[model samples]
Target: MKAFTDLEVWQRSRVLRNDISQLTKSFPSEEKYRLSDQIIRSSRSVGNNIAEGHGRFHYIDSSRFLITARGSLIETLDHLIVALDEKYITEEIFNKFKGDYETCLRMLNGYITYLRNQQPQKNG
Candidate 1:
């Protein structure tokens, strides 16, 4: 990969971030600084971490950031759950976003595994 944007996981995350941002815009102003902000931040974090990870160059270093990105993906999903509970979104919307989250999760996991396999074996 020449750039972080080239990663499929990063691309999926970007889509999720945009979707979350658009969804939050319909939320009541009362949640402007609360759940709305939380979801947006978490969604954005996924892509941010992926990019940062790719920039690290080393397998272990990149893996650390990828792990963080995975956490952010889970966090974003939790936020979506909260949105569903609060009726800010319908079941259909929630499911769609959930699918998007899962795709990113899978892609991220696959990338991490690929990185690990590509790492050089160390001899004592």
Candidate 2:
């Protein structure tokens, strides 16, 4: 298999990071180091963990990291929701970001399932 960098999930996550960064630009200045930073860091973590996990030698190890990445993705969505409710994002922007997050979630879940299915059978 190719490296994690070559994986679609990683690539998509990279795109998500850029999208989130752009979206956060309109956030209130007071959130410069608060909500904005948290969202950006959490979004990047999703991709970073996926890449790091791919470099690991064991399937279980990789799966664990991907799971962590998934958690980060959810956290990002929560932050997005807050931003929307606070009027930091319009309905259109919220829809756009929500779509991307849902897509990423699907991709992550698929990757996890793929990894689980690839594990070698263990002796009883």
Candidate 3:
């Protein structure tokens, strides 16, 4: 990939981040400092970590960042569950976002596994 933006994981994450931003707008003001803030930050971190990983030269380094990104994605999912419990979002909306997040997680895992399978050549 030429850049992190070229990665399917990053692209999907960017879309989800935007989606969460828009969805959170309907949340009550009380959540503005709590759930809303947390979900937004976690969502943004997913893409940020992917971009950072892409910038790394070593495959291992990149994979490590991707792992971190996956963690952030999971965090975002937890926030979604909380939102659902709080009635900030309906089950349908939560399910949709959950599906998207799960897809991103799987893609990231596949990419990380691919990276791990690579063997760096040593110059003789």
Cα lDDT listed for each candidate: 0.93, 0.94, 0.94
Candidate 3 per-residue C-alpha lDDT over 1-124 given as tens digits, one digit per residue, 9 for 90 to 100: 5977888889999999999999999999999999999999999999999999999989989999999999999999999999999999999999999999989998999999999889576889
Displacement of residue 97 (Cα, Å) in model 2 is 0.7
Model 3 ranges off by over 4 Å: 121-124
TM-score per prediction, in order, is 0.96, 0.96, 0.94
| Poorest 10 consecutive residues by lDDT, candidate 3 | 114-123
Error of 2 at 82 (Å): 0.6
Candidate 2 TM-score, C-alpha based? 0.96
Q: Write the per-residue lDDT of candidate 2 for residues 18-57, one digit (tens) a residue.
A: 9999989989999999999999999999999999899899
Residue 120, candidate 1: alpha-carbon lDDT? 95
Over 4 Å off in model 2, which ranges? none
Worst 10 residues of 2 by lDDT: 1-10
The TM-score of predicted model 1 comes to: 0.96
Instruction: State model 1's lDDT.
Output: 0.93
